[model samples]
Target: MDSATSDESIIAFDKWLETPPGAYVRAWEQACLDKMVANIFGFNAVQIGMPQIDALAANRMPHQWLADIRLHPRQSGTGRAVAVTLDSEELPFATNSMDLVVLPHVLEFSAEPHQVLREVERVLIPEGQVIVCGFNPVSLWGLRQVRGRLTGSHYLPKAGEFISMPRIKDWLKLLNMGVSQTQLGCYAPACRTERWLARYNFMDRAGPNYWPYFGAVYMVQAIKRVKGMRLIGPAWKQKTAKAGVPVPAANKHKESIDG
Candidate 1:
């Protein structure tokens, strides 16, 4: 990946994390992860975003896979072991090691977005889920570039580079990941003054599936692909159990009959 882009991304994310409002942003970030868990299940999950928030809720709602992702000590509710890592470079874990990877704001802020996406692919299991969240350069965040420079938010540079949705999709394609869903947010810069507009419209009107400030960050869930990719399952053992006593799933009770 590009070194310059990677460096920029690291700086941006670190700075964003340091901000006072980061906690709120962190809690709010579960939008994409919640959707991923709702749409897909059965795979072991990995929450790669900030502080590794295992608690996620969105339009679709969080499900079983939500628990599979180990959360950090500080963020993990029950104190489970959680490993933190970056996306612009190779992870310590082996390739195809993760069933699901969440990359929130890790790419847009990074100068080398492709590198981050590639790294995501490297750690993902085949047909694994990848949910990415970032600012929409065309919407409120983009406008924030101007407003930020005016008010000097410090987070935004006076002038610099930005990433777009189409560009992100192209990068994913290059990495052999297919875009399953895309949504925008924080329709505007999402400041304290715009609370009403941000809440009332973020999930419904700002974009096709989301609304304004919609958190000011958007989410895209993609799937890694192999030569032959197929859907996994609905875990319906009862449907097949009627025919004969077949193989028992992970948690089923073992039974036997003796003469």
Candidate 2:
């Protein structure tokens, strides 16, 4: 999609957050994020995109900031805290500076998700943790999304590339990061009404236990790895020679032959 269309799609999706399905997903994500980020101690933490979710609300970092391409001088009201308006593919933070990063559905909306992940790898320090939330493309929600797109009435954002969990893991592995933890939630069907959604609450218990990999949403925690490798071998020997001085090999046969 073009830039204008992408922007409109995101705006429409943000407005949809007020609806029942959107609100349900937001609550699930917030609860998951709270449990994951509460134990991570950091000096600086950044939450990129999805400013409405408040991904760092449970974090105890001394310096917490939210960044998004949509945040601007006019649309500065990003929930509880102010957010900086910047592209996720090009963050302004220094290299190896951020201790933690939270991406709440940013990759799905980004036109260049790989570039955004690369930028996240760049700004984070070694062993820094990154929490990513995404929609699983192999579940009931995924089926609904596909049907919605085919019918031209998507429940989620229409103009995003909904990436799979395995694909995201591969991307992280290529960046020298390892997945530390994985969480799956929101097993209910994509229902527009809260009453119908609550009716399928039993699926929450059954879905994860019977079909572990079929959750509608997933959260992955990854850590950047900095391997320390050193070369071990014999040290090089040095020989000193002064001007007009011959370096002797200390061989008696050479001396006797010369005499």
Candidate 3:
């Protein structure tokens, strides 16, 4: 998609996030994000796009930024003020500068999703992590979205090229980023109204156990690994003992006699 089209799609998606179904997805994503980022220790973190959800609020990182292709203020959610506006494929930050990077629904909307992943990998320090949230293309929600497109009505944003979890994993693997953790949620069927959503709430409870792989959305956490490098603990933990000084034979004999 062209930049103009992409921007429009993102804006529409942002607006959709305020709707009942959009809010439903946002709630699940927010909860997942909070848990995924809470324990991530880092100095710098960046959340790219979808300012409708604060993807890093639970994170304790001292320096955090919210970035997007276009500056959008927080509307229905709490998040950091937009710190930077730039393309996902071309981050302005220096290579290996970020400790954590959050991509919430960015890949699905981007024209060059692989390039975005490459950019993320370039900015992350060794062992630094990236958390990605995306709509699953293999669920009931996915079916509805497809049907919506065929009938000239769209359930999700038309610009979205929904990617499956396996594809995302492969993309990360190519960048030497290993998937460390994952979460799938929002099993409720695709319903426009809040009432119907509530009626199908039972699916949310039973989805994981019965239909584990077909959730509407997924969150993935991957860690960057540099070849032939391993993280070491504090230097004090690996301290070595010093060699003992040698003593003259006469002094050693005298000390023995005294004893």
lDDT of 1 by residue, 1-259 (tens): 2655444544555455545334345545554455556656534555554444553332232222222211122344424444453334455557887777666555544555676678779878889878877666676556767677778784443324566777778888888899998766444344433354345444445355443333455677788998776867666776677678656653344334321
lDDT of 3 by residue, 1-259 (tens): 8888888888889878888999999999988899999999979999998888888889999999888676444443573578778989899999999999999999999999999999999999999999999999999989998998889788888779999999999999999999999999999988899999999999999999999999999999999999995878776655532234468899999999999
Ordering by lDDT: 3, 2, 1
The lDDT per prediction is 0.57, 0.84, 0.90
TM-score for each model:
0.60, 0.85, 0.86
Winner by lDDT: 3
Which scores higher on lDDT, 1 or 2? 2
Best-fitting candidate, measured by TM-score? Answer: 3
Q: Please report the TM-score between candidate 2 and the true structure.
A: 0.85
The per-residue C-alpha lDDT of model 2 at residue 99 equals 94
Give the residue spans of candidate 3 off by over 4 A: 71-76, 229-259
Give RMSD (Å) of candidate 3 vs. truth: 6.5
Please give the distance, in angstroms, between residue 20's alpha carbon in candidate 1 and its true position after superposition.
8.5
Model 2, 1-259: lDDT tens per residue? Answer: 5566667767876777778888888889988999999999879999877766778878899999877667442243345555577877789989999999999888888888899899999999999999989999999989988999889988777776888899999999999999999999889988889999889889888987998898989999999999888966543322233354665777766887899
Per-model tally of clashing residue pairs: 15, 0, 0
